[model samples]
Target: MDQTEKNVQTLFSMGFLDIEDIKNALRISHNDLSEAVAILTNDQVRYGPYSSAGPAEDVEMKDVTSTALVPTAAPPPYNSLPDAKPCSPKPDYGNTAFPQTNLYELEQRVFVDQWSIPYKKDESLAKCLIAATSLAKEGNHP
Candidate 1:
């Protein structure tokens, strides 16, 4: 219904924590959805220790490493490798021959046969015969 409600629902659907935990995260993160998600995900909640209901069960929590949060090392520069040529070799376009014929003339010749409509019998005579037969059957004509 509202933006805050939608954000809360989104955080709930992420399957990380409960609604109360999500609300606490949203308050701590100043209603910023991204920050709220990051806080919940990074396990930086300051309200209180999160305790699951019932007896202690073996619930596996995924290890979040700092490297996973932020990339530690930048990728090696592209040009640092040996055998890397400076500027891609100029594309070879030497004396490439192309057809010089007019495209419109070629298209007209290619489609001349397809452009003509083919008829196996006289179209007007067929229509007239069909109309006459229908009229006779309906007793509207002798």
Candidate 2:
């Protein structure tokens, strides 16, 4: 296996699937958090933000029967069943960036004038602001 795969295996074997461990093992920045998480999916170790990655890599897949092979033919259509309606496309809400009303300009100005002046470690605030912007873009509130 390649270096990345081996590293993932070693980390998984050592139970280093938590966000901090994954970040350190993968050398992933906060900005690339989603991408880092995607790697876990390849190893069948899906994990939510608040949930730990499930199971371990060394486990084997269970032997299963072929349900498809034993399947019977489809039954005749019943007259009592209602006709399936065509699904209509959802309405497109035009591109609307949020807090929607340029309120972030004030925050931007404050950031520029205060914290950003001396280049302080404002990553937390920056992430929050960026998240707010993303939420607005998705038509969701902060």
Task: For residues 58-123, write the lDDT of model 1, one tens digit per residue.
Answer: 323455564455445643343453422243233222322221222232243336433322111322
Which pairs in model 2 have colliding backbones? none
User: Ten residues in a row with the worst lDDT in model 2?
Assistant: 113-122
Identify the runs in model 1 with alpha carbons over 4 angstroms from their true place: 43-142
| Candidate 2: stretches off by over 4 Å | 1-21, 28-31, 43-142
Model 2 per-residue lDDT tens digits across residues 1-142: 7666655566566555664456443653222434454544443444333334344322223455654555555432322224322222431234334322223333443453222211122222333455566676678864
Separately for all candidates shown, the number of backbone clashes (residues 3 or more apart, or on different chains) is 0, 0
Q: Choose the strongest candidate by lDDT.
A: 1
Q: How much is the lDDT of residue 30 in candidate 2?
A: 27
